[model samples]
Target chain A: MKLSEDEIRRITLTAINEMGDDATPELVKKAVSRAVSKLDTQPDFSKSTSSNQGRLILTSFGLNQTGVVAKITTELSECGCDLQDISQKLMDDFYTLIVIVDISGSSKNMSEIQEKMNKIAEALKIKIYLQHEEIFRQMHRI
Target chain B: MPFEFEEILETIKMTEIEHFDIRTVTMGISLRDCVDRNIEVTKQKMYDKILKYGSNHVKYAQEVEKRYGISIANKRISITPLSIPLDAFKWEDFVEVAKTLDKAAAEIGIDYLAGYSALVQKGFTNGELELLKSIPYTLSETKRICSSVNVASTKAGINIDAINLVAEAIKKTAEMTKDQDSIGCAKFVCFANAVEDNPFVAGAFHGISEPEVVLNVGISGPGVVLDAIKAAGSCDMNHLADVIKRTVFKITRAGELLGRKVAEQHGIPFGIVDVSLAPTPAEGDSIGDILMAMGLADIGGPGTTAALALLNDSVKKAGLMASTNVGGMSGAFIPVSEDQGMIRAVENGSLCIEKLEAMTCVCSVGLDMIAVPGDTTAATIAGVIADEAAIGIINDKTTAVRIIPAYGKKVGDSVDYGGLLGKAPIMSVRNINCSTFMGRGGRFPAPTRSLTN
Candidate 1:
């Protein structure tokens, strides 16, 4: 828990007034700790969901193969992942697919999803990379 | 698509093909409070403190890597300089501390743990002198421990006496570990104006003023920059610099994000991102390749220093724009052994010690990972270090010497330490005796540049 400057100043002033010229370093420390303990509210992180922690950017490429999207989407759906957007391109026999997924509602974590995707990639003879969308936002955006 | 198709592909290509990766995510843990009067107690306190803060360092970093899909090459730790805290102990006790640190680092699952260092740029304390005496043994006995000593700085001038001591320590470390191509010397560095929060190992130390613990990152992507410069095809110098800045800006952003994410996982304050273009032994990851791509015929050519200056400046400009906390040696690194192109240049007689020294005037480090004949005298090595320190003091930039006086190996012979230490071809050095000058060593007074304050 971190106290703001104003809160710390208030606490220090209050402690000094209460000590009334009798405060030593030890007593001041004790008073500050007691005052701080009075406001012991845990920092709530779960309520702040503004970050891109739950979003993932999935990129895949390989030789053009049928049912690749169906196979991938089925796996994601089974894992409770929501596919928000996708863009793909095909030239000659090679195809590349980029996907945006919101994994906040998914039961599995990033590692588990990556493990399942690795098996799918090996079976389909393609390469699939699932990375947090924050990385893209960091590099491509400001 | 919120992100352009080309941007997506560019990021992917940088990672999958161009060998883009975070070089190191070093956790700086201050061991200031762990010192005790008893050697055994001090050792125990140090071990427990390191484990308390560093047990999950590698695991958290791996989790971030999995989430971001960006590879982190090395997860390391740097602590308060050993000689500072253990200044009251004897040289033998310092060796015990080194072993304890090595053990703790191994248990923490890190490959390297730095901060076995001393800062004697002005003069040495009794304990600092003792620590220097213990370095050869500490380096020889410990596997994961890395040591460094600062013998010169801009404000305090050059400590030629300390340099001679460090030179002797280097020679002894080389001879002690001679069975492995004098590999122990690779783990030691002699610095002038060493930075406190540098995340790169063999040179990093948690400065005295740093917080209790912080995470610092070193970003590396020579291949990405090289490819970008090549793609700018036939452009003039200004256009080339613009191209390099844009590329570096994006990488620096990504590097900072990765660093902050890892720091968040560890619940530690995030430190600066070292925007140095450190090279690895792998092909296409060479800083020399980037220099050549900037139109240098080779690494040690005539215009090489100017090209490096441009690259280093652009790197700093982009890094400063990309992240608010850009520190460390944020420039281009030109270590010979770790860079494949530099190795090729040295092998072909293109890059030499003198040229590398001149290039260091513009870059971050000086004479890094250079190999010389086994018969090179301690005074000659001191001459080399003194020269490098003179450049660093005069310019007020961080410079270091990680030269390996490869034991029993002469010029035309190469020392192969494998892995990231890479392979260094022994370059010939002039045999002019500088001992009388070194023997008269008191202190090289501060340069005129030190009077800015």
Candidate 2:
């Protein structure tokens, strides 16, 4: 539970409620729970248990283990990150991990987590960057 | 009054409409260098390339999508024609590349990969011959890598010898992937004339004449067309034709204007606007649905060919009338997996290759996304290619085949192309072999000229 469970429920319900006026609280609660469950089941985020989600990918310097991709995915997941969609490929030895992750649930200090992830990158010897998902999607638009 | 007629024409031209937007921005990448002398290295190379290029496309396309209101339906990619690279390496290496492509695509948001291809039309390039030999392995190794053998092309003419090879390869590829779920690989396209800038899968690859990297959008909206057609009703066929023409004209205009805007926003010259009514899994927007709405209960049933022909003619008439910007095959696509209505008909034993071939007389890309048995021969595949090409030549239209022979699939099986193309039960091919005719290796004379000297 990144934010308080109550707050999480409130925000999700608000979104679902706003989507349609007749949207039931039960339906909103259920959809948000399901979405959270999906996020929880993600490969990297599955093991994480953080009350305050805090992280930002500062830069991604090509993939090294899957190449460097695991580090990026793990660092974000550890801080409660959710990937919306990703379309990446391998080119020679330098692995590139281009992805669009939704970090909206993280209510903790985002800059702190970003610095922490940068430190993690420094430790793991990988490059990671922090950019919005909207930017990521636009870059790939055809 | 005559001057008023011109004003009305201008007003009609100014009547702009917008519907659905582009979904995926698919970027095709060549996986050739990824192949290595060692099978393991080749596999590794294959895996590595998909992850790299796929991510690049996602990152770039999203930026463009926000600028233009057109939402990319899918973020996708295609690869280079694989036979040359595979022949330069080994057949098994093709499998490695397929695996790489599949995994890489999985990592990125890209749903499909094109360019698992072989060119057999102008006799077999050494790479193509090797590719023909490796169909089963290639089919079995990768989940997403689509395969297509060019059995006939306008520039290369028809190579009956290679066509024979394709029929054999079709069977082998079908068998290899049967257990893995019939793959979404677009396997074969018969082309009377092939364009260089197509952006659809199972068939999209950068031809030699392609720019460094071009952007093209395949705007699909059969739902919009069908709604308009339904409003028009069943009348004398010619009357319906006029209605269809007007509707297609409007639809093409919408696609062209959007395509141009998106290209401009991206700082890339807008290539061609493919005004094809590509169907999806949705109920309202299928080409098959439109056909049935035209009075045929079954897609490949009795009047299917006639309906398809009219649809084709009217779409072209309207599309040509709408925009000078049309480039790709600008007609309806008849892929079984993409249209739910099509899948239902096939599952009910209502459609067959015979009827589908008949319909190919009018389709933009000939015989797209067809799945066949594993034992089908490349020669038979070649025969199928030639049959489709014959229609295109006679009509002087661009037709392509993106056939996927499920490696181990048999008649009456099924596959899901996922996303926009959707899923469909596998339709069976007529159990006929064509080795003899394909063995006759020569070009059919070009179609008769239309203009008088």
Candidate 3:
């Protein structure tokens, strides 16, 4: 399905923020274009993600507040989320963030990781959602 | 924003770093090639050879040190130990030879002279034994010359037979120069395969294989690097590594520039640039002080080994990056008595031979500036030198020993060498006598069997 300009802006901002780039319109556009181009030629990268760990692609939204998206990082660490990579974007308001966490072999199950993340979002009142690294790759297609 | 040079530049404004220029550029010349039959002709040939090759050194070093704003300390020369046995006429023949060397050095404006040596290891030759017997008088009579004798080597073992001989030499030399009130020990050195092109003395002796005339540059800038490390205080591993690499890069540049200029002007082979932290008799500039400032208050303590190892690595890496001709004992020196920090530690009973051995594990060279009891047997000294050489062979690094068995000097007493060599506190040695082990003349091949890699 063809996405609207607003939907592309939101996705691009979140992806740029996830890639630890500035959350400006220009940075988001650049990161989105680069990531999309890379996703086309790259293989499935299935084995790149270690077997004992769970992966998450973190992205920042364009609808967020003026403050930084620090809580997700804090909550992830608290829940024993071993961060493998990070991407982020910052703007006037509504920052976007994307991060990959490895929960491989952790005693705390997926529910615990999500529960802490939910509490952080409710407390700080910032939006956060997750997708597997593979689906994120597909959605990030050019 | 760029780095704020506010603090460092301000300190630079306050301190006068270029206080004294290098007083001497001593080109260590070897006499191994000058050996031949006929005593008078050989003596004449030795003088001709030294004057012919080394005359240009003083003129060139003075010009270069002037150009660079660094003072050319001294323009001097060190020859291979004359091995008096080469001239078997009498003790007087050895003394005359010293005079001839003095004349040759003076002719070149090289006031400081060394290489008046006696190799009495294993056993002295007929002429060597007599010449070694008469070195103190020979040294006292000479005008401006320094000397050394390698009474011990890993291959030759130790010549315990020369203990009483050297003891007599020291006392007489001290007595002969006592009226003149000059430091006599500065004229002599104890060696363990002494390095070629070493700019330091009286330990500076030309190795046999060197080109008759060559320029070796001993680059020293410990204060510079120590300041850099302290600036990166308490950083993580990566940051610490960065600070070390940057500081080394700068100092090595200074050494290479000065060393090359001296070689070219003198029209000699630029032998090697030794990037060693050669400590002077200065108060705060000592290598030991740098280590102590790094958290080991006394150099022989627990943190000592790690500190020395870091120092050695940083110096070599920086020098290697700075120039291609990296040679000599390009490591940190741990000479006691020479550095103020070492003397203080030894006097307070905080440093000893065992701790020095451990420091050797981290720093460069073996037990240096060690002062043993006067009554120490020849065999004991040889044993000590062997143990040090073993460390060098096993680790595949160049190490040396320059011990002083001060005559009539007991442990706990301090012997003063005044300037440069500084003053030494009497350090006692373990009473164990390993003469039997040292007497066995053979090579202990590198410890290859122990290495898993």
Q: Which candidate tops DockQ?
A: 1
Interface RMSD, in order shown = 4.0, 19.6, 27.3
Model 2: DockQ vs. true structure: 0.01
Q: Candidate 3, residues B224-299: lDDT per residue as tens digits?
A: 6566667667766456556666655554555566666676665566777776776666776577777776667677
The local lDDT score (0 to 100) that residue B269 gets in candidate 2 is 57
Q: Which ten residues in a row have the lowest lDDT in candidate 2 chain B?
A: B1-10
lDDT score, candidate 1, position B178: 98
- Candidate 3 residue runs with Cα over 4 Å from true position: A1-142, B1-15, B18-24, B28-38, B84-92, B117-137, B140-144, B148-187, B433-453
Model 2 alpha-carbon miss at residue B38, Å:
11
All candidates: TM-score:
0.92, 0.63, 0.64
Candidate 1: residue pairs that collide? none
Model 1 error, position B298 (Å): 1.9
| Candidates' chain B TM-scores in the order shown | 0.99, 0.78, 0.81
lDDT of 3 by residue, A1-142 (tens): 3443445776666685676644677766777777666556755422212223456444435466544456677667766778777666566765656666677646565545655666667766765554334322221221
Clashes within 3 Å, all models in order = 0, 111, 33
Q: Tell me what TM-score chain A of model 2 achieves.
A: 0.46
Global CA lDDT of candidate 1, please? 0.91
Which runs in model 1 stand beyond 4 Å of their true positions? Answer: A1-53, B450-453
For DockQ, candidate 1 versus 2, the one ahead is 1
What is the DockQ for all candidates, taken in turn?
0.37, 0.01, 0.01
